[model samples]
Target: MSCQEPEFVTAEDVGGFDDLWSSYGFYNEGCFEKGAPLVLNDQQLFSDFAFMDDMHFDSISSAISVAAETDQPASNSELLQLDEKSTPPLPSKTSELLSKYQFKFNARSGEKPNESIERGGSKLSTEDFMRIAASFFIQLSTHKDCNPFMLNNQFGLSFSGLSSAEIMNVELAILLFSAAEKVSQQRFDHGTNLIKECYKLCSKTGNSVQRVVYYFADALQERIHGGKGTVVKAQEVMKALLSNHPVHLATFRSLPLEQIMQFTSVQTILDNLGSAKKIHLIDLSIKHGLQWTILMQALSNSSSVDYVKISAVGTSEEEITSTGKRLTSFAEILKLPFVFKPVIVSDIKELKEDMFKIEETETIALYSSMDMNTMIIKPDRLENVMKVIRNLRPQIVTVVDVEAKHNSRSFINRFTEALFYFSAFFDCLENCMRGDERVRMIVEEDFFSPGISSIVAAEGSERVIRQVGIDVWRLFFARYGLVEAELNQWSVYQASLLVKHFACGESYSFEVNGKALLVGWKGTPLHFISAWKFQ
Candidate 1:
């Protein structure tokens, strides 16, 4: 199962629309093309898992069993040390991979998701919002037009080894900081003060690990956004800010929309008479069981569905446990029979890492809310995922991932585009204000210096700015014969929330430095496409 074999294909192999389409079996067969590739026919992807074409499932079983017996459980102190180990070292091999695929400076002329103009309206649609949200990751992974230096400038500064969580730590920090800057109040006083405070706290507790930096950065950004202008650095004041400061990382599981949609979708699908018996919910990063909670509720309400079991897999036990707790709490609150099993994996090699050996293939269904490319970027890994999908022969295989392009060609543009868009947001706002001093201070002092966008633009940085992750995911899905479906209701709810809370009644269409950009609240429905495998 070692991916020692290298089958590298140049961008030319799959570059042109016609060439790429033919190579991937997209144009020839209509089965692959569909709406956005949010989640496609679940059955097709997992159907291959049942076919054991020299797949070493037994090997995985043996390895898992051995690991279970030989592994010594780490205590609290050991666990804390383990957390420390999560911080990845700088100059990672993946850093180059990231740098190669920067965000693009694509025109923002594309239609907004579910936006409307009624003096007040939703900004996007459920389908479009999901696509956009997913696109965020796509832009991060594939686009190449962005500033690549940001990765090093921000989180890549230092690291022992970069784990997926560490990468996410940096990404999450950048995302939150950017979001805060866009929506924060008292930009000048609050933003700077928060950054300084976070810096001091990190110094006392730990160094500038990606997680710490991001956490502090995000918190400061959030506080500033919340209109908190307190100026007290953690160390200089010689006093603690609070009696007890809890780690306040915003969990995606907390997003009611995602939670509700996932649960509802699973239940709705399973309740159908033709639905399969066994159901699986696969998520790349299961922070908490918030998603499963909703699923559990939906399953409970279903008249046909009796017992729904969940196998929630993530990168680490900490993540699994966090998700498990959410599922457990949901059960406690609703009093349902929903059991969520947790499986922790460090890399894609572990997909079958501990899969139990069986004499014959099982009709197992698979679902994933993660980047499909993560499993396929490497040939062997990609084949492994495909092998698993083929073997399971699941009636359904719903995969949710960023569909952005990070291939050899579009890497630079992706990052550049992201930087441009972020810069544009601030620049547009600044222009609107006629160059306000406070705005300038916010941009120059707190916003510009260490922003993730800025980091991507830095020299030798692996970071790239991209439009968003969701759109790229949709395209990727189409390439793979996964049919897109209509946007889920939860997405619609999120779109509504953004419009209700964050919409500004200003419609201005202007080119930013020759790049067409659209800024305003127009009632244009966010375009969301879903794909299905008709075959």
Candidate 2:
């Protein structure tokens, strides 16, 4: 080993081999001779027929969707658009109706309004805060403790009592509870009054008891005023992938989400491959290169293959370069000759055959872990790309996609679906991510917020995070002349082990849908992993 370089044993020393091959030249010059476009082999049919299924953004609508919960029906008139005409006057009987509830406000029993509250208005007491908070929490689909917590709903938000700040929290919570159309609309009207009052009291900053006034203020502008809070920089969105900013770390490290599902992605490619002299894997989008490292170690443990080459493609040259270096280090640790190819693509139009260099008599596999479909933003481009892929004739192509109806063209439909989808995601975090409030906030603010913001606020090319379900993806692949291939049963068994290993056995479940596996929390599907071969 060189003085500066890290030293490691040969693959043979660890895996019962007598010799290890040296790193060959990066590209296979011999196979550059282009072959005529290969025809889709129809003889490779696996399943006869199968069914299928289906992120956040920013915008005026996105703003409301993010800060304002949509438990009520939303409409152009009903939605609080600040620039629009003044919101309707608060219902005269609203306070009276609310007083009928079992609130028992701690307004000194015999005193008048001014004696109870300095401002001479009927301000709610600390107990009132808990009652209000409980109301909205009960309507939540996420939050594991929603029901159990509701059993003892008498908890206080602030002992002193209500302020515009706490009122803002209550208003926000009301929006969060997804109620029926009529109820949601009613809540929107009531919440609008709270928004107005909160802003009116904004000048008296001291009265804003909740320490986080700006958060509430921002949401007010976004939700009630139809304000698109802030335009998120594209780089910031991508940076979230690496940021240890609580959100990314929680998502990047945890179980049933990033780590375990990532394990499933790697195993999908490794399972049931016959002996070959060399292995070539092409990743359409290598955000972290995590799966490759896990795969490299697993490959090192086996004596089946000799050379491994990884061609990583992404929008960032830096990420691709970084991933290459990391993969190279792992390969060296196993004393294996590994090649990492970095392909930078600024647009889907940049995708071409030249990005992939075929090697003579080598086994090739393609992976699009939560990638590919995202790049197919248009029909013509998607078709052309599929044509390009069809020409590669890879041994297999593995795809993992988010399972939600989040890609609809209609903004209303997309926004509505996002609420339900992310609610479940948050619930997963709450039940599964105990003692990690900071992580949850990060995931919600930085990760979920930005994503939701993009989906809600952005349009056209800015909306790159659009995702569709696996069933739709099956049809998409079929157009390229591909069929779903069953992941080996061993890989299926590994799925259960991954859950148990994560110590989240009770929190997650897996289903083998034909050859595809749907791994999700409780009964809700989060992601699907399936492999494909020529149809």
Per-candidate clash tally? 111, 24
Per-residue lDDT of model 2, residues 1-535, tens digit only? 0111112212111121101000100112222122211121222111111111112111223323422342333232222112111111111122332443223445446543223232223343222332354333332212323321122232232213333344444543332222111112333443344444334333212221221222233333344334343345433654455322334445566655676666766777787356765898888777767788877887786776778999886667775787688789989999777889877777656688777778778788888765554443444445445656677878888878786655555443454345445645655665566666666566555655656655544455555456666655654455345778877677567667766756445667676665678777655567888889975
* Candidate with the greatest lDDT versus the true structure: 2
Q: Point out where model 2 deviates above 4 Å.
A: 1-250, 301-304, 376-384, 409-412, 456-464
Cα RMSDs, all models = 20.7, 22.9
Per-residue lDDT of candidate 1, residues 106-206 (tens digit): 12245242222111232221122222222333333333333312443333322212333333334333333333332222333434543543343332123
In order of appearance, the predictions have TM-scores of 0.40, 0.59
lDDT (Cα, 0-100) at 407 in candidate 2: 59
> Where does the lowest 10-residue lDDT sum fall in candidate 1?
236-245
Assess each prediction's global lDDT (C-alpha) against the native. Answer: 0.34, 0.50
Error of 1 at 340 (Å): 2.4
Error of 1 at 408 (Å): 6.4
